[model samples]
Target chain A: MRLLHAVWTDMRFQWKHGFYLVYVLVTIIYLIILSFLPNDILSVGLPLVVFSDPSVLGLFFVGGIIMLEKMQGVLSVLVVSPLRTIEYILSKVVSLAFVSVLAAFAITGFSSYGSVSWLLLFLSTVLTSGIFTLCGIMITAGCNTVNQYIIKTVPYMLLFVLPCFSLTGFPYSDLFTVIPSVAALRLMLGAYMGIPLYEAISLVIYLTGMNYLFMRWAIRVFENKIIYQN
Target chain B: MLQIIHLKNDLRQILRDPIMAILMVVPLLLIIAFKLMVLYLVPFIQALIEFDILPYLYYVFVFVVIMCASMLGIVTGFMMIDDRDGKISELMSVTPLGRNGYLINRLLFSSVLSVFYSILGYYVLNVVELPFVTILFVSLLSSNYSIIIGLLIFTFADDKVKGLAFAKAINSLTLFAFTDLLALKWLTVLSWFFPPYWITLVVQTPHTLLVYGLALLVNFGWLFLLIRHYRKK
Candidate 1:
């Protein structure tokens, strides 16, 4: 019940701050522009767009949300409340995941009607959003300002996103599977090209493990850097 | 004298901030990476390409230089937003430095860094066959767009979160500069409203004095409008 209230509160904050509006506008623009491309191109481009919009967008905007809350002294207040750390973190992750799922569906459904698997898309979007949002919280844990957050996260962002670019062309390597985004990308691509049972099982396992690890890290960092420090 | 003092203080602040130090160093590192990519990766990729690689390299060079400037502008915008949140801008407004002096300090800092990065990026990319004066002139003109972006960020964003969002949105829009490589006529016409698009055009067609003039006018006009809006608010 408290988690639901927290999600509602965060959603209201996000809505009031225009994050939702910007997000919807960006999604609409991406869909409109992508609708112009050929189907084969859209097949490749759709996954990349999903990787960027929902996954990376969640990472960045959630980081900003946390930073904003920190600046507004809300985190300090929440730390003293009855709300557990897991509950607080879950609220953010779940709310962002909800938005990410809607966006991923909208983009995929609009662009590729009959070709893609809706179930795989839903799983990939939710898991990837969870991973990136947790990563964002972890990255911004010690940051007092946005500039500092950005500066610190650039290398990490590159570390995460750059590897995903390898999906574009030749020189395919299994090494990329170690990156969480690679797992997410595999799931997204699987939606289009039919997932093998082994690939599906393994990616699901890998992404789940990564999301758990990232969530644990986020909670630990939030406790030490944000809650205790404050 | 006042400008010198403000500049000195701003430089010291940048030096002291670890994030600003990272921002400074990241560009230098990227310049090195760009040089390596041109020397090593470009040749490899060029082998796969059917067309001339020189034009592609030129576009990438312009894109990198302008991107450097844009990143520097974002850094400056973050600094200004930080100051606003910390009430330092308020404090400065009460002093002889005033708000205008504060803004000028930010503008000077961002423009100087933008020009430096632009030149360094050009040198690293090593694709510009133009004369030294032309390269320098283009870099200066390109750097003004960074100033415009910095001021636009300051005017539109009220805090660090809003600043980040605004910076991302602005940078994404400015990336329309890359569309210039497509050479699509209608798209190029639409790209004119974006300042960095003019920079790409100026680099591609250096002989066109009218393009150069328009670049300067658009950037300066936006900078002025943003500043006026900020002051009014």
Candidate 2:
């Protein structure tokens, strides 16, 4: 299908630009650095670190990809093509989600040492990547350049990413669960330990719902700002 | 007079740039946030860690300031790369500004912003009680590291994506100042090679003229080498 071809092209383009290499290098380095920490701190910190890396990393990488395509006028061509807008958008989300899942696995596999559930890890990463990549696409929709994209997204980035730092410590608050990242972090932490079936199911439901809403919003924004504007 | 005109134009361009404006504002807001954290969250953090973290607050303040300086450097580097990509630098080469003139203008712009952020960081954090002259001296010396970062970023990064990767890598390397607090003997020994480490050292031991001089020499040496490499490229 055209969607698969587009996704493959995007993946190849990103790989050619060294995005994959930089990502792997960052993962390896982060794991190595975490290994240096004392065991007590490392155990408590691993979930938060994993949450920050693949989950939040999509925000920057996907934003960069969209901005690059916008700058090169590739999106304008896509807008005029017979390819459906949803397919084009899905290609981006799927490609970035693939990369994010790989990064999450690399980090968890190397750092957690079989302590966390692989099933939970995969679920959290897919949901987190899908949510954040759509967020990136939405944020970059109205911007034509990287600088503009950064300016518009800084406040959102701070809001989305900074609150998860609080989850690293104890005195767990019900208030933190309202943030999607905190929800993802809770799932990750639960995977490290164990989670009640209901809790795991609820969090997955919440993330899936949020992902659907964000995907809808991103598609709308892309149609209005990117497609129609061109 | 020509330099003044160039400076004015450069400042206007920065102001017009949304990304530069965001970068300028974010650091100030972070400084304010740090102040609030020290005022409110310190007690909570102390309770959590079950130790007095107050003594190490000065280093934390310096780390934040150095981070701001490095960010400015990366932004400046991106601006230069943008110029190159758009052929603006090539066009300016034939203008009255010339290439060297343009380079100095960009360096001055970034360095001055670095100094401003450093001073703002020091005054806002207010953790260390140093003489005003010492603060200014250290800030001026620290700003050179930002210039060095800018040049290195420009030399290595061909586009925005590569520029971002280099910026992250360089920042990770330069943030060794924080490692000095880990109290690891080998890390301290290794920290001596990094200019930000020297800046933190100067902050910790301001009375030591030797440490201050070494920071100056290292920062200048790196700046010289980076600029030379960039020019050759």
Candidate 3:
């Protein structure tokens, strides 16, 4: 369908814009840094590293992409095109989520050497990137420039990223898991340090629910602020 | 008069955006956060993990200030790209200000901001106490880094999106500031060519006139090279 085509086009656009090159360089740097860590630290560090960098890169990247499109007047054309708003949002999320998952896998695969659960890592990265990318789309919709988009993301990043400290054996971490970032980090940590089946299932379901809510919100924002220019 | 008008316009552009206003202060916030982390979190981590990070605090602080400078550099870079996209720079080239005047105005603005941020970051962090002269000179050397970064982004990226990517790549090179920490003999030699390494070297050994001279030389070398390349573009 058109959604798949949009995603493919978005991916090509991202590649042409050098997002993939940045990811490759960043992944290689993460690999180098992780390789230098001691084994004991590496185990604890791998998930934290992956959780912070690759999973949330979309939050930083989507703003630049949207702002650039707006500055170039591409959004005006898209407004009249047959491309649905949901497809536009999903294209960005899916394309960026693709990079995030690849980066997570490459980082975890080489650093952990197949000792971690692939399925959990995949699910964690997919949902985490999806949620953050949607959050990005929602934030960028109201902003005019990349600088505004970046600075506006600060409080939201603090909201999402700071709670993730609970993953480091903080007390009452289970209570924090309801927050999507915490849940995503828990899943990322779980990928390395095996969680109970029920915990994994619950975290996955919670994150999926959060992604749906975020996507709905993002579509509304894009339709109003970006599509309609209201 | 022209520079004043340009400055007024730039100030208006930044001040009008509430988010841009916040961006200006994020570095100060980062410094406060670093201060708090050292005061509270470091000890907590040391107690919990028994891994003390106090010894490496100097290098960490150096990296933070350099990072602050780079953030300004990237912001100025985006502004320049915005000007290009809007045809403002093109329009300015035909004015009495000239293209070179516009470029210097931007470079000077970021340099001045970087200098201010560097000095303020040092005072706020309050680690590695040094003489006022040392801090002033180090901040001066670090300012060129912002100029270099700004010109590099302007010369390299034709649009803001690519500028973001280029900014990440260029900022990663700031990692060279820690070449001494890595303690790799080969990297140490390689990092000598990087301006950040020399700025850090001056910080670690502030008394050496030779180090200060070399830092100035390396930083200005890069600044000169970037300006030439930018002019060519």
Best by lDDT: 3
Candidate 1: regions farther than 4 A off: A28-42, A110-114, A158-178, B51-53, B182-186
lDDT (tens digit, per residue) of candidate 1 on A1-230: 99999999977876676666666766766775686677777878887788777756667777778887888899889978988999999999988888788778877777744578878888888889998888889888878777788777787878877887677656766678889988898888898778897998889889989989998888998899888874
Clashes of 3: 0
Residue A90 lDDT, candidate 1, scale 0-100: 92
Best by DockQ: 3
Off by over 4 Å in 3: A112-114, A169-171, B48-52
DockQ of 1: 0.50
lDDT of 3 by residue, A1-230 (tens): 99999999989988897888988887876776677788888888898888888899889889889988897788888888899888888999999999999889888877744479899999999999999999999999888777778788888999998887776675677688889999999898889889999999999999999999999999998888888778
lDDT tens digits by residue: candidate 1, B1-233: 88898899888987898788888667677788888888888888879866668666777777777777888888888788888888998999988988898888888887887788888888777877776766887778667877877887888877766776677677666556766555567767877877878777778888878887898787777777887898899
**Model 2 Cα lDDT, one tens digit per residue, B1-233:** 88889899988877887577777677788788888998889888888887788888887578776877787787778778878877888888888988888888887887887888889888888987877877897778667877888887778877776666676567665546766656667767877887878778888888888887888887788888887887787
Which lDDT value does model 2 have at A84?
A: 89
Quote the lDDT for B151 in model 3: 88
What digit string (tens of lDDT, one per residue) describes model 3 on residues B1-233? Answer: 88989888878877897676777777787788888987887788888876667777777578877887888888888878878987999998999999999998887877888889889878878778777898998788768888888888899897877888898778668867886766678878988999889878888898999998888888888888888888887
* Interface Cα RMSD of candidate 2: 2.6
User: lDDT-based ranking, best first?
Assistant: 3, 1, 2
TM-score, chain B only, every model? 0.93, 0.94, 0.94
